[model samples]
Target: MSALTVSQEEVKRLKGIGFLNNKGTDDFSARIVTVNGKVSASQHRLMADAAEKFGNGMLAYTTRLSVEVQGIPYEKVEEFQKFIAQEGLTTGGTGAKVRPIVSCKGTTCQYGLLDSYALSEKIFHRFYEGYRDVELPHKFKIAVGGCPNNCVKPNLNDVGIIGQRIPVVDAEKCKGCKKCAMEAACPNGFAKVVDGKIHIDTENCRHCGRCVGKCPFHTTDESIYGYKIYIGGRWGKKVSRGRALDIIFTSEDETLDMIEKILLFYKENGKKGERFAETIERIRFENVERQLLPSC
Candidate 1:
């Protein structure tokens, strides 16, 4: 039994496969992919076993909705991978490829507008697994937030999908009280009591639909429930918040299509060793906007 020797190039390659080299040691840390931060009871048990056996007796959760088992010896990496495989878990959410999709607990949360877990799962399978081999200048991050509350901070990712609800008020059903419930419900103050009626300021309304269930008379109708997309946002040494696009995808299928298109556009136009944010800056947001939304 001799000590295993790992070169720098091997370390880089291993990192691309989700094995991060531990500082000042030949040991590695394994990042286990978990879609939208979900893990079953049995899977959790296996992970705990791996952590105790292969690495340190602890697991670390990443911001991108994955788990890392630290302090794995370089030689036991393959064995650990096999141990997790019986429970249907895999690694490799690193490198320049699309990273694991992160999402807030939208389905179970009271403030949720859409199923963030489901959406994130779809994106993970469609993009993360699908684009595992695709090389890019920088890692692409995607996040899904359930509502305007932005619990997951979608605006901080390379691609952000925010669930939105556009309230449609029926003026005929108005029993406009002096202090309308809609007015009180609106976080942005978009709903106003004007001339004894509740008037929603279209310009100012973020379409969060907080007023929908709050209207005492039930005048507010959720006419639209969809996703608001943002692009080119990242947090790093040079942080830039993503710009929200005017486009609102009405369906999950439409949202997935748009995501594919954005990735394709980035793959083609993004410069070598430059992030999507940098690409947006170099080519100008207006130009990228035109390419992303030609109809607009």
Candidate 2:
């Protein structure tokens, strides 16, 4: 076959479209898209075939819940993209836009408090797919954690959504046992026995509802389950943990609306080449919070 040649500008464009130049001459790696780390068995087989055909028969999983096939020649990129498109797969998670949405397997996990896969898929479609071409100050990332376990490390992403279960104590049914259920169930030590009664420190509570059903008297109520949002977080060379907002969205629609508003606000107020975390720091989180949640 003939040798493949590409320009520096073309390589940059290719990287934006999910192709990365490998160490080998003219070889590239293709980053395939996946939704919340979910892929069907058939899709896996297709990936295997693609890897064997165009790549070095190797596949790697990205921390962002995507797949990459390495060692494909530059000449085959167009053909490889077309082959993956037949299976409803595409590329382009890199750029100054929203990256792929990631989530843990909340639906099947014992400690999961919400359907993270479903919620992440919704986010993937609405934001990742919707804002595929929209320019941003820097790359944006989003993560959904099932509960306070934070398996997906929501606090390390640009936008973090964590499922929360608020525990409500029913004093009427309290047995007032020596060893309160909250003491054992609460992971953050927010629950304690105070003067022969169970006291839950609201400020320290993570709202994970670990105390629910732990009481012999069944005093912990698990009726309140919602989502907590954190903004201005990023994990990189300069790491900054996101700050959690006081707002708890009661419905998925509300959470989705809030995220959309956040994106719009960031687009309007953020300076070029600045990350959301930097923007929050520059303008002060309080001022940004006021703009995002004026009712607060």
Candidate 3:
């Protein structure tokens, strides 16, 4: 007998949440509550209590420092959210708007280069309210990374912000010990000993900024500023990958401007219900870039 291959739908058991309607309506009627920043043990207790009281006692942690409450009927969503607000939480990630922006766990860990929490705050303060009620063709996801380790997988998001620093090597000062290559734990094997000299494979290295910390002789450089942006990526039914939008070296204002420009371009040119990736696919990458990034 052959083993059965379970279908994804069967495995998911979508109707288990009871959000589905009787006539076959989409399961987009659920409301969520988001509580970010320093999460306390007390918060967990409250969440559990509230879930059992008002919700299904089921909580789902989102990638963007929020939680979802499924199974709430359409009529009771507002009331559920109101009850949740009393417990210091409010509805978020509900509707076709900019969801909570998130960043990798940075600063708390040794591997982190930038302050993720602070950056997330910046994004929220700048654009969150503006997008609260605005409708769009599809859901959008954005993530920021402090380094090239890709904790947020910037290459796979609609808009990805990754910290980057140009490495400057001092060849004359280098002893050719190859410690950076041999001992350092680089996933891409960027550093290597060529002709008894330490050679950094720029292409292979993810520019994760780890090598800068691992180098014994302090050969790695970290003076450069700015981020690399990617656009038009998503992971749902129509899986698509984004491409490098640009290598921008400027203030946070510039980065946000670029993102808004791309979004606006998509809104103007894209068909109804078409996502950023779909628009990109419909129009060639070059044309899209040319229209969006005229300065590039």
Top-TM-score candidate index: 2
TM-score for all models, in order of appearance: 0.95, 0.96, 0.77
lDDT of 1 at 291: 88
User: TM-score of the candidate numbered 2?
Assistant: 0.96
State each candidate's clash count. 0, 0, 0
Give the residue spans of candidate 2 off by over 4 A: 1-4
Report the error of model 3 at residue 14, Å. 18
Residue 153, candidate 1: alpha-carbon lDDT: 85
Model 2 Cα lDDT, one tens digit per residue, 26-48: 88889999998899988899999
lDDT score of model 1? 0.88
Against the correct fold, how does model 3 do in TM-score?
A: 0.77
Evaluated against the true structure, the overall lDDT of model 3 is 0.62
Q: How high is the CA lDDT of each candidate model? A: 0.88, 0.89, 0.62
- Sort the predicted structures by TM-score, highest score first: 2, 1, 3
Query: Candidate 2 overall Cα lDDT vs. reference?
Result: 0.89
